[model samples]
Target: MSGIAKTPEPPYYAVIFASQRTEGDRGYGIMADKMVELAYQQEGFLGVESARDEGLGITVSYWESLEAIKNWKEHSAHKIAQDRGKAEWYAIFSLRVCKVERHSFFEM
Candidate 1:
């Protein structure tokens, strides 16, 4: 082993969140960080990738099961943030969940 544990192959799900922020995002940075940390502690959460520029933000999180995704949706703090995103933070948003039947990655 190269001391770097490889990510497991196949049998995974990805939740992709794409959003456009409203006027201001004064508290969004902190809240986003908190959400990422909380997600890592959730059962079945595998990994995440996020990027933001100007007023657009995109985040993709990997999970082991649909149940885990449902649990995360029902999580209280996340619920609160979801509400805030609708009413205050996001001007527009979209969420997509896809099963990863197969995947491949390359390293330099």
Candidate 2:
């Protein structure tokens, strides 16, 4: 099945993160790529979308369960990055997790 087909129907979870970086990203690009790769290898991870410009970034990741989301949150490397975000990388940020009961997409 395609990646889109694997997305769970209704009642899935999304982790939305919005951030403003503090300075030059330095190793951020590489780390972000690695993080995406790691997340895809994780059990229950559905998909991810990210975009950034002028020090602002947004990342949204889909998951199968709350437990999976929690596991990702507690991941050691992710925790280290989270600390870096708070202390040095990010000027401001917010994380929101929502239960998605329904969605739709169209392409032309």
Choose the strongest candidate by lDDT. Answer: 1
Q: Which regions in candidate 2 have their CA more than 4 angstroms from the true location?
A: 1-6
lDDT tens digits by residue: candidate 2, 1-108? 113334667789999999998887767777787788888888889998777789778888999999999999999988877787687788899999999999887656
Position 12, candidate 2: lDDT = 93
Q: Candidate 1: worst 10 consecutive residues by lDDT? A: 1-10
Candidate 1 per-residue lDDT over residues 1-108, each given as its tens digit: 112223468798999999999887768778888898899899988888777889778888889999999999999999988988888999899999999898887778
CA displacement after TM-score superposition, residue 84 of candidate 2 (Å) = 1.6
TM-score per candidate: 0.90, 0.88
lDDT of each: 0.85, 0.83
